[model samples]
Target: MSVLIETTAGNITLDLFVESQPLPCFNFLKLCKLNYYFFTPFHTIDKDFSVHCGNPNYPNPPNIISSSIIEDTQFQDQSLSPYLLAPKSTIKPTLGTFSFVKSIHENQQVFDSRFIITLSDSFDDSLENQVIPFGQIIEGFTVLETINNTPIESIELKRPLRDIRITYIHILHDPFPDPNNFHPYPLEPSEFQLSTMRFPELSKTTKDINSDNNNEYNALTLELVGDLPHYSIKPSPETLFVAKLNPITTSESLEIVFGRFGNVKNVNIILEPKTKKSLCYGFVEYNEQHEAESAYRKLSKGCVIDGRKLHIDFSQSVR
Candidate 1:
């Protein structure tokens, strides 16, 4: 069966694998029939990665019936246990795939109500056992792109600066039979450890090169490799790929230099996984692509900071 979701961005249609995910499919269908997804915001949007919604907590239009209430009243006979056993086959969370998020506590896995639709490719192995893919987008990819490209106000939480809400959901066809006696299966604890890394501290002063002796500066260039792992759907003109950074360079120092061009959305210095120290390279995302392009061009022409000549270019990677 197919489902049509009407959102503030646009309509997105999904093709469900009812046979593969009967429990989740029927559960989602039942909720849609009751208008359970109305006014729900896409709270987590990872540009070029995914758009996640279905949080019962942060619904639009202020107050509405909570999922918990619905579970207690209308779904009294239905099993609302969050952890259901999924298929053994590993599903790659590629572009346009749909999956449900799982939360772990005290070595038990429970499903969250959130639904995630991939906007681009992802190969995170940690997601293999945690997310259960049950569907794929059949239409409205451009709308997905629009949502993925939305300017992010917060990087850590992945919240969009503007709101994107699910106005309604229309089930075109539902073929799965409800499993009223469904029970959640127990799961082993996941091995993946969540990262607790934070950006490095910024330098207090950025030393600028004297205009009269600019030629004395030797540019330190790091060879560009394949695009960065995370990026937006389209190449952001307002984002810069910075390289050859001093290992000690702080996100604060980059913000000061780039903020001169325009409002800096985020300054990220890629860090070593184990040490959590600077990788001597980073990215700066701006509110406007033009601002990022401007910073890249101007800085590439040989800008010196803290006695180090920097190499800058337009970032081609998407997060």
Candidate 2:
């Protein structure tokens, strides 16, 4: 079976190994037919490494074509069925090779919804038993490279500067006749909820800011404290410290405000852990240092956010 992924970066065609990896290939094909990949962002882009996607929680939910895919069967049983053949004993993950991401539970590893495509020649012996390489990209290597080279806001998390979203997935071919026969149990509620997650629309001001702020920021912060011979690292200049947020301000609002400066890598709102209430402060990271500086200067000059003047500065914490 084969599928064509139309992403903001470009189109990539993947050939599935249905004979060798029936369960994963079948599930992937089914998801494609149901338009499960629409608008899903490629959350991780590690240059010279790999680009990761299929995350249901990064920006928003998958565009589910049918609730049946979510209600039909449990992913764990289908993925780990004894009837299914084991993955190849060894995998040489070259560029364009596709594989599933695994989640660790105690000593056991379970399949996660996320998947990755290698961007370089590399292999992981430990992943041979855990991750299943069900497909290989047959086209659009350049698109993958473009995604890998996209500016990033966080090197540690490998988040893209701007969301490279999957526009849609078109199933070109599928040989499976009785894919439903492989079902085991009903999908868990949490899994279904995750597949249907949604987020509010970004504000116009935020959109305008992201469009205008295009310069890349790459400055590193070095701190030298008195009596200390070694210099300590501070947060990247691309990261902004935000304070005096309205108590009722939401993470979405914070994102819209700071996101104007540049592509927001991440936004963290300090909260009362137990109550999950906003503590009226947060941090926002941009892809470039100039973006953060612009936000700091503009917002510090006293921008009213939800009726409160926001305090912005460079964060002291290291990235």
For residues 1-319, what per-residue lDDT tens digits would candidate 2 score against the true structure?
Answer: 2765666555576878777776667667766655555556676677887788885456543323222242254433343354256555244667898887655545665454568888887656655665668788866676787787888877787777555666555555677543434432221213333233222232343344432342210010001111112223333778876766788988889889778878999998766544666656667989888888888877877788899877666764442
Off by over 4 Å in 1: 59-86, 105-107, 177-319
In candidate 1, residue 303 scores what lDDT? 77
Over all chains combined, what TM-score does candidate 1 have? 0.49
Model 2 steric clash pairs: 217-288, 217-289
Candidate 2 ranges with C-alpha deviation above 4 Å: 59-83, 86-89, 105-108, 124-130, 178-204, 207-319
Q: Rate the local accuracy (lDDT) of all candidates.
A: 0.61, 0.61
Worst 10-residue lDDT window for candidate 2 reads 216-225
Highest TM-score scorer: 2
Among all windows of 10 consecutive residues in model 1, the one with the lowest summed lDDT is 188-197
